[model samples]
Target: MDLKVDPEEMDCNQPVPVEVFASRSTLHGLSHILTYERICIKRCLWILFFMGSLSFLVCVCVDRVQFYFEYPHVTKLDEVSAPVMIFPAITVCNLNSFRFRSVTRNDLYHAGELLALLNRRYEIRDPHLVEESVMETLKFKADFHNFKPRPFNMFEFYDRTGHDIKDMLLACHYRGMECGAENFDVVSHRLSETHNLILASSHAGEP
Candidate 1:
């Protein structure tokens, strides 16, 4: 005896149901759980595993959702009465920065051909081609990241151009009470070249 399946019967117009999708899905043992016809030990085990996995995932999602909503803190406002607070030490800095007029002619003279070339470039004139270039020019290297010592005195330049605290702070006060220049000792910032600083002395508590 021989059996044959008809092509017409195999090719149905009806869409494949969700059971087919479940069978092909990545969910481990779900196909087995759904397809199992009877109450066997294997089917019960798959059902238990699937439910436990789903529950754990739902708990994690709930925890993450709670964390997202609770990210910002609550704000509150209140009124209180207290004695006047001390005026903080103020430092004025960098009022006049990199003034071209302050650039001394001495620096331009020391800068030599580099500044000359730039000046020529500004005037739309090409650089003068030197037939006999110096050994230093031939072996020239440029590194912008590392700080190099300036040919000119940076300290003098900063002092001449940087801001003055006496000029900046015309008046000082705490809770409408006036403060004098004696309270602020004018000082240069030790760590930097450009900032003019003022420090409040320990005698700030004195009347």
Candidate 2:
């Protein structure tokens, strides 16, 4: 007996299926989608980070602006019935050499007496030292925050008369003078107020 073989049946042994190709194409599409999603997530995270940094910067700026604008309450010496006497540690800068020295109550009192004498038109034997003392006293008072009035220009007063507070004090020591009441009164009053404030602040920290 002789057997007959078909040519199409031999080709069908290596047949390619449509389902395998479809599954491979589907896997490529899913991979592309996953990559796109990862990029989107990264962009969202970066945006959020930038926004947080911007928000912090804005908050800091606002807080600094508020701090600069706001003024703390300062109690006047006259407001207290009996003002406490406090000798705060003062650093005095010498005008000639620009050297600094620690000032004591004695130094202040001596300067005040000299100021009083100048107010009374009494001649100062050592005008130079007296001038130095007055400048140091003024500088010490100025060190205390808000002791002087706002827009207080020290240079303006200094430029008027050889940068000498002594001359200014001598000229306007008496009442009805060109600059009104004695400059010593202004200095003393401010000094007293500054002293009281210092005392109050020091005692505030006490138990």
Candidate 3:
């Protein structure tokens, strides 16, 4: 068979098969794979992240609901007196380590006892901790201040009290050192004067 081809159609450099066109059109190279695959992978990752974020939000809401329902009686403040008025104002002055602004009497008593223990055992004190512990006790105040509470004005309190709460804590820490507690000084270094005072005053009455 004489298969004579036209000169215009017979470019010797050109590939003869239709597969040449198909191969060129298909994405077979590394560049093609990277460009196409990257977009697909990124889209899948974003979807997964979105799902995880939504699930986390749902979990937080569920926890809040559970807490509110579980402690309905504790949330009630109608019978609870004003923490500022009921608790001795003198104790509220310098303690910053303790959360005290909106606590109940029961909490205050508990904190006071704890403070007394720290003082009696280690000769330590921190007024701020005592005050904070007081606030922790008062249901209404503590719950209200559960978010960001007003910061204690330490300088103002210190000036009014004429007692350096830090000094009191340091004195206790020295006592702890005598008992071979190396960590006591480190704790005292971290806490402010107010905190030290609270530790000192925590357990003054109970034997």
Candidate 4:
């Protein structure tokens, strides 16, 4: 038998071989290998998902156990009635003025009464501790937050004098006002509002 092959149909004047055709015909076998590879990938994904879920459940369980174990102590503390005194706000120009006679009269009276109550309640006799308690009580006054009207520079004063009592006092006064207006009461009120709204929304969402 004679076979006729066209030159135009050949690559570089050589006819295409049967082995090359056979190789091309068997290329579909690679698809089966790919299907097995996909199955392996799916199995690996399932294993990873199961492990992640298990780890998350374990963490939740540990947190629940810790929270419950601390609940009894928290409840006991909540039951104890502590003495609390509410003081009216004092409006003062500065801390130095606050230490004076005219500006802090009502504040001083309430403060002294609160101190006596605290001393009777806690039986604390130390002078330094008593002084600290008096200061802490005074801090509760509403006008405490409104006095320091501006921010004073500390870094500049420290740079100039090495240490300046007057500058530091001014900074403290400024900070107290800032705390009242910007840091303490305003933020606390906002936070409380936000928390209450969130809680209300959550309760609404629940049954």
Compare the candidates by TM-score and give the number of the best one: 1
Ten-residue segment with the worst summed lDDT in candidate 2? 190-199
Error of 4 at 87 (Å): 16
- The pairs that clash in candidate 1 are none
Superposed model 4: Cα runs more than 4 Å off: 1-38, 72-207
Report the lDDT tens digits of candidate 4 across residue range 1-207: 999987776776775465455445655433333232457766566557656777898999999999899875533444754586232222222222122222142333333344242243233235455456465544443233344433333333223323223322232223133222221121111211121101122222222
Error of 1 at 127 (Å): 73
Worst 10-residue lDDT window for candidate 4 reads: 190-199
Return the candidate ranking by lDDT, descending.
Answer: 1, 3, 2, 4
lDDT digits (tens) for residues 27-143 of candidate 1 = 887788877367688788988999999999999999999989998678898977557735455665664443433444443333323434224222211334533342223223221
In candidate 2, how many Å is residue 207 off?
32
How many residue pairs clash per model?
Answer: 0, 0, 33, 2
Q: Rate the local accuracy (lDDT) of all candidates.
A: 0.56, 0.39, 0.41, 0.38
* Residue 190 lDDT, candidate 2, scale 0-100: 22
Greater lDDT among 1 and 4 belongs to 1
Clashes of 1: 0
Model 2, 1-207: lDDT tens digits are 897768887767866554445445654333333242457766566567666777998999999899888975777665554466453222122233111233333332334343342323223334565567666554453243443333423233222212223322333211332432122222221212121111122332221
